[model samples]
Target: MTKSNNSATLNLQYGGGFRMSSVIPVIRKFNRFYTNVLGLLDQHLLETDFSLSEARVLFEIGHTDRCTAKMLIDKLRLDAGYLSRILKRFEEQDLIYRIQSDEDRRLYYLRLTDRGRDALAKLDARSDDQIRLMIGHLPEQAQRNIAKNMAAIENALSDDPQIRQEVRIRCDLKPGDVGSLIHLHGWIYAKECGYNHVFESYVCQTFVDFFKHYSPDKDRFWFAEAGDEIVGAIAIVGHPDRRAQLRWFIVHPEYRGLGLGKRLLQESLQYSKEKGFRRVFLETTEDQKTAIAMYERAGFRKIAEHENHLWGVHHIEQTYELQLP
Candidate 1:
């Protein structure tokens, strides 16, 4: 009998009344790729004594000076025992050190040694060079296509309810990320809110120009990323009058209706209050009924109205103000 080369062979039977299991074959193929081709399974088998898992733990420790075991478990999703073994192996190598928490002796904190830091840095450099070599072979459009497809797959996976429950919002706001927030907001308004490109373009330009004249220390931006993809964002810029101007609030269409937008708004307001702002204000079109309502519910009151040319006509721009407690 001859072995079949047809793609449809995956669905055919190799035995009596029993179809061949495709899963095992696929897993084996992946194992071969990761072990032989990618050289990930035991790439450092002779060069280094650490397993892949141990190397990963060292990498995480090198990135942050102080991290608790719980933080590492949460970030990597590794089983407690598995992570413990890896930690122990690194400790034996004197590559990492752990200390018991003074407050809770049961809790352990981990940090990398100088040797571990140097090792992790070399690993990062090697990984970067490897990716650059592989991606360099692809054309610009092909690379973009890979990025788009990967993003779509990631967003789809994050939509799972089980995964959503584990997602956490990050509070740190960095400069230049405000531009990303502005882009997201404009894109959401144009796509989900059914506005035209004119409104989005104008709003984006307004945000860019506003950030240029204003210092970022006086301004704040926040973003929510689920496994490295930006799902939502918001920003508050300081007005010359000492008021916090809320702007560029947006949640991706995939993440909307999940209360992420409300969360971002609440956090932004809280950050503004902490920064010594007495009052907060924002402007939105009358058509943004849901957003306007949310602002009102959050103690913001409509103070004035104006015309917005970006709306392509005379659109009512409602300004909402909230007094910080």
Candidate 2:
């Protein structure tokens, strides 16, 4: 949490041979797209003779209270000789001045001159203007979606855990909500269970069936949102005999231990009760140990099961029932 330890370090394990997922090409494509976007914006960096790196140095020097060359070296991880040259240039240009530290005369602190402040202000304005122009035509909601997705990508790849807080649940579907959930299901299951196209096809078919049997008043689909992104979901669909079927229950791998699964399960059960359902049931796989454990702890009894090879794996199909008073 402290700035000193904010940088992330990842640990990876490599096998002698491993099969890369089909998603790698798509990820590389997005990487190219994002790289281009940044390249476009970078065309308008600091207008002075300073390169972008030099401008960054100036900004950090201006902001850090007790800026020193050692701090800059550690923070930026730049070659000390190269940074000393940049600082020398700034001094020659009258943009920054150094003062001797009172306690340690050998160490000098950096400060921006009046001209340096003006230059920094101009650089900041230009950066903001470029971003505004880039996303100006997008609707507000679309802009938020872009921002949220970008943050999600950053968080997924980050070694440090994302800022934690209570996740929020919304019980309504938006335009692209179903599509995102389907994609999450496909991606997560493929990674976790070795599931392939057959599983995705089954999920698509379920969505189609859901549309055909949809009843708004008696059914609920809850999305667990955290950090402005959909991370988990569960649903309770009404059936005859005062029963409800829980469907499409999932929690993102990155957010599994945050109580999101339990919260979503609680919400689904509560909603089924509110809808006057006397019994609640769900179908899951034996491989879903965490979810099954939660169900058992919540008083769900396994009523039926069969063995079969589906979703690219040999797993048991289980049906769990919970009697609701």
Clashes of each: 0, 0
RMSD of every prediction: 10.8, 10.2
- Candidate 2 colliding pairs: none
Candidate 1 lDDT tens digits, 1-325:
2335544454453323344465567557656764674564346432556666666777778775568777778877899999888887778877888888888888777888888888788777766666677688999887777666556655575634544533467757656565666577666766555667787677778866885777767877677876555677778888766699997776777776778888889889888888888899998888888888889889999999987665545567888899988
Q: Write down the TM-score of every candidate.
A: 0.51, 0.60
Top candidate, metric TM-score: 2
Residue-level lDDT for 192 in candidate 2 = 90
Score each candidate by Cα lDDT: 0.73, 0.84
Model 1 global lDDT (CA atoms, 0 to 1)? 0.73
lDDT of 2 by residue, 214-239 (tens): 88888889998876778899999899
